[model samples]
Target: GEYEVLGEIGRGAMGVVYRARPVGTNLVVALKRVEASGLEGTEAVRRFREEVENASGLRHPHIVPIYHVGEQDGRPFYTMALIGGGSLEQKLGQYQADPRAAVTLLAKVARAVHYAHQRRLLHRDLKPGNILLDEAGEPQVADFGLATKLDPGGAAAGGPMAGSLPWMAPEAVRRDATLTTAVDVWALGVILYELLTGRRPFGGKDRSEMRTGILQAELIPPRVVNPRVSRDLDAICRRCLESDPDKRYESASALALDLERWLRDEPVRARNTGRLERLVKWTRRRPATASGLTFLALLLVAGIVAAVTMANEQDARLRQEVCRGNEFAARHVASTVLAQLQHFGEAVEGTAASTKLTEACDGGDWPAVEELLKARLLDTPPGPGAPPFATAFVLDPEGIIRAECPQRHRVVGGDFRDRDYFRGARARADRPEGERVHLSRVFTSKNDGLDKLAVSVPFRLKSGGPVWVLGATVPTDATLGVGGLHDKARKAFSVLLAPRESDGEEYVILVHPGYESREPSVPFPAGRLRPTETGFAADDDYADPVAARHPDYRGRWLAGFAPVPGTDLVVLVQQPYDEAVAPYRAFFRKFLEWLVAAAVVGALLVAGLWLSRSGHGARV
Candidate 1:
């Protein structure tokens, strides 16, 4: 023997693989030997040779590389890279709990399969058992014994239908059906489904039942089986399991691409987006300012593809990109708004919780509390990091404005019991001392006659006295406040929507694009400026990009929403869909015109050559 057989690693249908070291070398390798039963005839020997040939032809980081081939005692054997981490089948438990890891591993495997496909080789028996993982958990495709070169039609031409039964495609089960790369995709889908849901998409008692299941059983969506599975992942898995070969991903590469998109938090081609999820995904992706550069790069790539695809389809792709861009922008702005709101809320909470302010309120010192509020207000200067609050005030247990910053003496004794800010703070008095602050609904100030939003916290004055509320108000139209949603282009802007008090209640827009220009005299009702799809369900639908016309805004828009944590405020970023996509559409139109002109020129040249040939024949 030319090698020292360390031990038998595993056995399969046709042969056994062993851990061995070549004779005169310290290197370890996997040496596979054909069993006596497998080497019974010339056909078996040829199959053994073919496996080595097929595996050797593939050169990829994720594919097992063949090292040597030989025979011993009339039994053929071949040596290849020794993978110590074992097969994917042995390590399936890790993926059971983490669908993302499963997807990532499968994506790499799918790429290896795609590599083989590009070389006209088909891995007819792709399964977890055949996928070897290295020590670092990187997947390396192995066992290409069933691999066959693709015929002229890009399908397996002849030979008996062979593949792992459980992971086979419906077409593969039908012996006479043409087999393409789709069978491998079907297996990849099965692997993904099992990883996501911890169970196979189709199961049965026996081979016949399994075939029947593959051919006819309805695939339970991955999300339905495992509630934790995301909608995007479910869609990707379902697309791979589609019974119709044409409906499945056209190639293994396409399947891998969809998986990559899911990992990147981008909209996958497995399903149409432009739904609420797209916006939600953008938050996780943390869309950066480089989105424009990303779009430009995508545009360059698309221009190259424009040559093969129809101009109309190219135009659609461009629009899709723009829609995504709008979603990204909206998500970015929403995050900024949420951070700012959280900063303000923290400041208000911190000031109210201070020992000095607490001592002033804990005693019968309304004047002292008023002075403390004024000093605290000045501490946070009116600059970039300043709180948006224009005035800070203290109210007695009777809801009387006891004292206020900048000393509005005329309103010091005014009662504000009916005000939402006062009521909101009082309502939360039963809560823990640290958690007693409340963000009130939008309302107009009685004294200033201007729209105001308030954050109020409840505290007790003198252990014997009833609880008092300390509050701060930000004018709705303040330049640096939520109401100041200034979008210079008017194409896109951010709006702050106050959450509904109860189910089925309308969501009021506390801030809007034109809030600065609105008349101060006209009273704005709480429900007057409601926007559609502002409910909790719509805000939570995070698997699709939200692109539709907002009824209140009166135009089709691509929007993204983010909820301000620990508060009832929601930030909505809306971009007019048409305006966002216009530039891309114009570029596509120019590309289409060039394509048409080139076609016309080529046609004219052909016609001219034909006429000259006819005239030359007449002269002869």
Candidate 2:
């Protein structure tokens, strides 16, 4: 027959197997050829012939049948049904074993070994590598050269010792020079252990370590390595690896019976220790892998996002609190100023002598009224002059300054007709018995000085006609504390008061403390003041430059067009972003440290388990 030889299917210690197609049927078949070098002498040749004869007699479906055994081209050769699906070892490595699939495949292998045993043939090597998977993925045990015929003195010279050392039974390792089905049972247990845990039971760094460990050390519980393995499955694996052959299943059939029972949900004969059983249950409950860690990381990220959202909410609330506090203070100061103005109006109205201007207007005759005004209507300690009035003045219906305190820089003759404060007061005065003390909107003073707030009240004569306007001035600085001029972090803040124009534009009127003189100063037009988005005109009223930039200026500052309680003025407070959230920053850093630490600990645990298993495999 014209058979085309393809490639080698697999190689073993004794021979090589090749895939080939027969010419007659064009069907694939595996050919096993014993190397001539391996059959060195007459004794080796005789041993090869014996193995061939033994393999040719096996006819089970799970056992690879030897179709022909002959001498081809001066080399001993044999042909069998070629397994299209390759070896069991390859499948095990490629696909992680599902418990059901593992049990099914294992049961098939056990059945094959049992059939061989019943036929008086013991397969000394029964490992995954020797178990071939056909095109249908069914297990077919091959490489029966190491098979012991179970007849006294019929086993080959090197047969028992020829199998894989790691899969060898304890009796085989000790060179007990015996042939028994128990050896096959031990190999089956090792294969089951490897399938469940992805590793060998007993192994360490070197061959010596593996040999010694396998003989002395206890196997790592399968559930410890693979939590998916059931306690009953683990018990089955441990029993097969028992040192004493007497303790092992009597035969492959008996082993298969127990495996079938386990598959059927029936309890096997094997006993499970309390801790080992608990570990198996735990593994089934939650696999000890990075998947859990991955889930935890996702939860942690979600928590962090939630925490950040809450922090932002808290930050907004704190900002509102601070703003509300400043507004309350501004209203309190304005109310105090309004009350003083009302008192001043009553005193002037009550005294007819004071209402009429005497020809000689000397300081001593008006001392009592002057003293009264200075004492009640001025800031305490009043510097070193008559007094620093708490309100700025605008006069009569024409809107001009009549009298001012701190007599050193008298503004009595100054005209303020174009100012918003004067116009607003004049309009109020026109009303019949209108508001006696009219509060004005916030505006910049034409006087090239720091920003000041003005308060005006009409003086009604005995004849029922308006006489003059009495008022007072309060500097922006005195109303808002020096600390309030800077941010909470102590960063410097700038203020500018500009007049609003009819064209909707505003022009700079006064730079507080003359811009250049303030500490930690801000830049401004040095030459002549010009109109700008930030600039205010003399007749317009607005908040300081810093306050104007605020989105909540109308609601928070309580100054400007809206009159604050006690007085009419706006107050602004600015702080640096870093200083505003310093506490939160510190908290975030601590949280980050804890998160990193947790990740490190989790990674270390995973790495340690991985390395330990790798080391165990290396020894095996």
Clash count, one per candidate: 9, 20
RMSD of model 2, in Å? Answer: 33.0
Instruction: Provide the TM-score for each candidate, comma-separated.
Output: 0.45, 0.42
How do the residues 1-620 of candidate 1 rate in per-residue lDDT, one tens digit apiece?
Answer: 79999999988777889999999999999999887774647676788788988888788999999998888888889999999998998888788788789989999999999999999998989888999999999999999988888886679753476878888888888874467888889999998887787778889998889989888888889888889888899899999999988899999999999999999999899778777687668645544323433454455556547644664575566546644554455555556666565555566666777888878766758788777877765457333554446688878888998778767676688998877788899888878755676887666665676655687887764454587788887654413343335465746566666643332244555566554532241222334323445332112112112112223455555555555556666666566656666876677678767756655565566556656867898999
Clashing pairs in 1: 274-545, 275-544, 275-545, 277-542, 277-543, 277-544, 278-544, 278-545, 362-462
- lDDT (CA) per prediction: 0.73, 0.59
lDDT of 2 by residue, 1-620 (tens): 34677887767656777888666676777877776575545555666676888788888888888887667666677788777787878777543458777778888889889888877787777788888888888988987777767764333233335667778787777677665788888899989888887788887687677778768887787888888888888888888999888888887777888788888998777754467678677667546454556566786787678768877787766555544443344344335433444544343222212433221122223334334445445544223222244443325445655444434345556776776556655556545443555544444444444444455555543445655555554443322222233332344232333233222233332223223222221222322233234221111122334333334322222121112234322222233344445677788778867866776787778767767877898999
Q: In model 2, how many backbone clashes occur?
A: 20
Measured by lDDT, the strongest candidate is 1
